[model samples]
Target: MKNALLIATACLLGLLSTTGASLPYPILPPLFVNGAPDSLTHFLGLPPKLLFALALMVNPIGLLLGTAVLGSLSDRYGRRPLLLVTAVGAAIGHVLTAWALASRSYPLFLVARFGTGLLEGHSAIVRAMLADRLQGPLRNHALSWLNGALHLGWLVGPLLAGFTIAWGLTIPFYIAAGALLLGAALVGFALERKPRAAGPSWWSVARERHAFNLLRHDGLRALFGVQLAYTCGVTAFYEFYPLWLVEVGHYDTRAIALVNVGMCGLMTCSALFAGRASRTEPMRRAAWLAACVALAIGSLGVGHLWVGLVGIMAFGLPHAFYNAVVQAWAADRFGGGHGQGAVMGLLSTTFCLANILMAAAGAVLTLVDTRLVLLTGAILTAWAANRMRAWGSGAMAGLPPAA
Candidate 1:
């Protein structure tokens, strides 16, 4: 019962992290168009384009910092305390962001976002916590559910942001802030504590041979590369997709929000399915991953909104399967005390670096046709598939055949 509670609480907190971060974003286009020259231009001391780029860049960097630091701290101190800290801090950040938005304070908004990122460590932290407590099927299942919560938040947040911002652009932040408080309460009361020794510090972990050694392992390296590629691809879509819909497809904000709902909805459904599927077969893992890469690549090549929706559905469906399979495989490969924390941190760093590059690239590509960006993603996905195949074949050679 206690273990179940911890997992449930973790899932809730995970949902809070993603949904809260995304709330301000779905409304960003409307906000940018309507409020930007008035609210952000002079405050940011950069062109609107440059400010948007900076904002996008900072979000993932903050997440990267949060996961790297907090995941490690959770390893050292235990999940409960940091969970508490993050929840409370996130609540504060959200409320402050709402006020900042009302005041049209860009610097304050950036500060709020940075703080939110620091407190937003719930996803990575909970993932490590589950790794500590569960194994095999249960662990994979938990991760899937965790991802589902993220997608669920994704599904609802944009639409909510769209509608709520009608009242005030800053209003969505208050709603998001309320969710964080509720999440904090859920976590504080339900989560059980299990403290362990502090693992290596970030620099110490970086210096360690095994930490570096994990990257050298052919299979893990391929998995890590795939992770990087997919992250870049996803960030590309997230950063540019709505803009493409507006500019090329001529869709309004409501239309774009609806499309986002479809994509996030499919992703949420896929996570639930993948959670169940991961325990049964590992090669199923590779197949789902391949499917994800293909769909994500294909989505960009299509132009019409209906056709594009089909591609978007394809793009989202295999995400959690690929994620669970890859992470499960990594956990199985690197099983030890604090090894999960280290692996997660490295993965977080890689994805963040990918996000930064993709955002920069996406910003540039928006000046061109977004379709070309998708083709570049497709090529990388193909490269990742070949690498995963080689890595899988080599790594599986010694192990018993999949059941």
Candidate 2:
């Protein structure tokens, strides 16, 4: 019963964290546009393009710093305390963001987003916690469920935002804040504390050779590269997909949200299926290659409305499978090590860096052609897929086969 409760709490944390992270996506572009009455560009007195990019940039920067700092801290202190602190801090950040939006204060809003990113390292901690508690197939299954919870949150957040955004642009932030507080309460009460002897400080962890040594292994390096490339592709696709819809399909906010719902829904189902599928490492690698091909095809097809919709769904479905498989692979490698937090932190940092670059690139690419940006993502993803074939075969030499 206690184990079940812990798993349930972790899943809930995943849901809340992802929902909070995704809520702003459907609403932010319109709010940051030039000459949109009472928008961030108008209030901040900045160019529309610059303000839009900065809005995307700040959050990921905060996330990179926070994950790099806090993931190691969770190892030194304890997961329970770190989880509680970050959750409450995130809630506060959300409240402040809502206030900033209400007052039309651009600087305050930037600060709020940065703070939120710093505190949102909870996802890494949650994964580390689950990895600590479960082993082998059980761990993979639990993580898959957590992934499902995340996509479910993504599905709900945009739908909720689409509905409530009609009421007020800032309304979604307030609702997200409430969910974070609730998540804090759940973590405070449900998660059992397991303290260890103090581990190395964040700086010490960085200086240590053990964490760095893992990268010397060819398979691990490839896995990390795959994650980076995948994130780059995903960030590019999502950052511009809404704009594409508006420009090419003549869709409204609600329609975009509906499209997101379908995509996320497919992603959720794919993750759930991955949890049950009896997949070997080679098979998983093959599927990842196939997914990259689908993403490329879908991205290239985005010029047509129905074709683009199908492409987005195709991109989403394989994404869930690849994420679960790679994460499980990483957890297998890092399990029972002092560097779990550090390694996860590095992974989070990589993801954040990818997002930061893609966001900036997407903004600039809009100047050229929107479809070209997605095609660029397709090319990157395809390259990563081809690399994985060599890396997967080489990495499997000594590692135990997937159960």
Highest TM-score, which number? 2
**TM-scores, all models, native as reference:** 0.86, 0.89
Candidate 1 — number of clashing residue pairs?
Answer: 0
Candidate 1 backbone collisions, by pair: none
Per-prediction RMSD in angstroms? Answer: 3.6, 3.2
Q: Which runs in model 1 stand beyond 4 Å of their true positions?
A: 33-36, 39-47, 193-219, 277-284, 395-403
Tens-place lDDT per residue, model 2, 256-312, is 789889988988888776665444664356446445644644454458877887787
Model 1: weakest 10-residue lDDT segment is 204-213
The 0-to-1 C-alpha lDDT of every candidate, in the order given, reads: 0.68, 0.73
In candidate 2, where is summed lDDT lowest over 10 consecutive residues? 205-214
